[model samples]
Target: MKVCYLISAVSSDNTGRGGHYESLKILAESIYENGLDVEIVSLGDIFPPTFGNTSVKVRFIQFKKSDSLIQYIKKVADEIYDISPNVIHSFDNKSYFFARLANVKIKCKLVLTKPGGPNPKLFFPRCNDLIVFSQENFAFFKSRSRYKDVNVHYLPNRAKKILCDDLRIREIKELYDISGKVILRIARICDSYKESFIQLINLVNGLNDQGFSCTAVIIGFIQDQHVYDEIIALDCKYLRVVTEERYTKNASALIDLCDYFLGTGRGVFEAALLNKLVFTTISSSRYPVIIDEDNIDELQHNNFSPRSILKNRTEASSKEFLSSVIQILSDEIKLNEKRKYILSVAKQRFDISSVMDSYMEIYLNCFPFKRNLIFDIILNSLVVLKVYALLKLSKNKKAKA
Candidate 1:
C-alpha cells in the first residue's frame, strides 16, 4: 500500500533541528527501505538538504500569501487526490488539521502522530489511528470522552545509536572552547523553556564558582528571539549558547563530549543510548532530576519530559538544587551504575527496528472506515472555539496585570 507522510515542513535545513522532523526522516527512510511506496507531502517549502540525500519523493504545496485558509487546504487536498495515497499520515497539529479537512474530500485512511505533549489549544482530529510517543499522553487522551472511540497507541520515540569521528569531536570541542566537566542541553530556545535555561546557566556558574570544573553548552533552534536574547544577555562565563545555524549536524554526537545531558524528549533517550547521564526539570523548576534506574520508567512514561513531573512539582531553593547535583556528581561509582542501567533500558525500549515493526502493523491495519464528517467538523470547530476563548482570557489577565 502507498503511504503519504504529510508534514508542515521538511526541515529548517539538511540537518534537521526538531524532534518531529528527525523522527519523520528516520521513519520515512525505514519505510522506504522496506520496499513500500513512500512519499512525503509538505505544506511548507522543502529544504534541499533534507530531500537531496533521500530516495523518497517529496511534494511541496505552495501557499499564496493572499489565499484564505479554505483555499490553502484545497490546494493540499488537490495534491493528495492526485497522489491517491492509500494512507495519509500527518505529523504536527497544523498538518493534521489540514489532513482532516482535506480527507473529507478524498476519504482516505488518516493517521496522526502527536509529536509533543498535548496542547489544550489544538484539537486531535478523528482519524483511523492516533499514535502518541509517551504513556502519559496515551492515558491523557484515553481518559477523554471525545477519544473513547479512537484507537490510541503508546509508542516510545526511537533513536539509532550515533557515532561521530574522533576528529570531528575534537574540532567541535576546540571551536566551542569546551573543557572541564561538560553539561550539555539540546532543545528549542522558547518562552516555555526560558526559566529552565536561566536556572541551568546559573547552576553551571555556581558549580564553577564553588571550584568545580564545569561548563554548559546549550544548542537549539531559536523559536523565540526574546527568550534567546535573554539567555545570551545573561553572559555567564560557564555557559555557551549554540544556535541552529552553528550546530547543524546530528546533536547526539555532542553527547559523547559531555558528562551530563540537561534536556528532555528524544534527546534524553538519545543520551541514554549513548550511556550519558540524563537530567530533566519541569517548567519553572528550581532543581533538575537525574533520570536514573529508580525513575527511568516514570520519566519514560512522559517521554522523558519535564511535563512528566509538572503535576507534583515543587520549587526547591537553588542551594538545595546544587547540593543534590554535587552529591550525584561526586559519586563516580553510582554515576557509572546509573549509566549502565539507562543504556540497557534504552536498548530494550527504543530499538528502531522494533519501532518500525509496530508502525508497519498500524499502517497495514488502518483500513478505510465510515466517518461522520458533519459531526466531526462541528466537534473540531467547538474545540477551536474553546482554545480561542482561553487565549482571550489569558490576554485579558495579562492586560490587567
Candidate 2:
C-alpha cells in the first residue's frame, strides 16, 4: 500500500536530539523494504539521503513553521490532491494537530506516532489511530474518553543504529580520556525541562558526596544559554562538554567505556543496545516517556522541596536522589542483571523487524479498504523466512571461507 509520511522537520544538518528524524528514517526504510509504495512530505530543508536512490518517491512541500492551521491545510491539500496516498501518517502532536484540523472527512487514513514530550496528556485533534510508545499511556488515554470512536495503539520506541564504523575500542578509551568505569549522560545540554536539569545537578552532587569516583561525560548539544553557564561553572574535569563532531563520535565510543548511564535521558535504549547500564526514574505521568525503565526510582517529593533555586536533597527530607543513588551503588549485581535483561528484551521486542510488523499491523487496521488474501499472507511469510535463512548462511560461509 502507498503511504504518505509527514513530519515537522527532518534536517540532517541540524537534527536536534528532540527531533525524531532518525525514527522517521527507520520507518521510511522499512516501508520501502516491505515493497510498499511510499512518499515523504516534510517541512524545512531536510531531505532523505536516499530520496532518489530508492523506488519510493520523496516530495517536499516547503511551508513556513509559523503558517496557521487553515493556511497549512490549504498548502498540504493542494499537494495531497496532486499525489493522493492510501494513508497519511503524522509524526507527532504538532503535525498531527495541523493535519487533522486540515482534513475533516480525512480522505486518506490518518495515523499519528506520539514519542513523548515535555507536556504529557497532549490534547490533539483526533485521528484514525493514536500510536503511543507505551501501552500504559495508551490505556490511560483510552480510559479518559477524549475521542469516543478513535483507536489507540501501543508500539515500543525502536532503538537507533548509529552510522558508526568499527574502531579500536582503546582509541575511544584514550580519546575521551575515560577510565572505562565512568558514568555517562548523553542528554542535550539545552532542554525544555527545568526539573530535568535540577534533578541532574542534584544527582551529581549526591554521587560526589558518596565518593563515587565515576566520571560523567555530557554528550549532545547545549540548548539553553543559562544551562550552559551553569555547566561551565562546575569546571569539573570528569564532566566535560563537547559539541558537534566530537559529540557524535564520542557517543558511539562512550558506549563501550561507560559502565552505566545515569540521567533522565533520551538515550537509555541507545545505551542498552551498545551493552551499557541505563538508570533513570520512571518520570511522573506529567511527563511522556517512550522507553520503559528496567528500574524506576520512585520520586520522593519532600526531599525535592527547596525554598529557592538551590534545593535540599537530604535523607531527612524524603530521600529522593540520595537514596536511589545509594541503592544503585550498593547493588552492582542488580545493575548487571538489568543490563542483561535489557539486551534480552531488546533483541526480542524492539528489533527493527518486530517494529516494522507493528507499523504494518497499524497500517492494515487503519485502511481495511486495501485487502490482501490469506494466501498472500502465507506467501509473504515464507519469503521472509527464506530471506532470513539465506542471509544467515551467507554470513556463516563468509566466516568459514
lDDT of each: 0.72, 0.54
In order of listing, the candidates' clash counts read 0, 3
Candidate 1: give the clashing pairs: none
**Residue pairs with clashing backbones, model 2:** 189-221, 190-223, 190-224
What candidate 1 gets wrong by more than 4 Å, as runs, is 9-17, 45-55, 66-71, 101-107, 119-122, 165-171, 248-250, 310-324, 378-401
Candidate 2 structure lDDT: 0.54
Q: What is the lDDT of residue 219 in candidate 1?
A: 76
RMSD per candidate (Å) reads: 5.8, 14.3
- The residue-by-residue lDDT of candidate 1 on 1-401, one tens digit each, is 78899877423221234677767767787888887889887764334234444568888785433444456667878888888887888876556766777676777788889876644455566665888888878888888887877888888888767664467557668888987788888777887667668767877887776667899988777878999888888889888887755454455566777889886787777888888887786554555677776667777777876666655545577677677678778889878887888888888888676677788888888756446656766666564344334444555576789
Q: Which ten residues in a row have the lowest lDDT in candidate 2?
A: 299-308
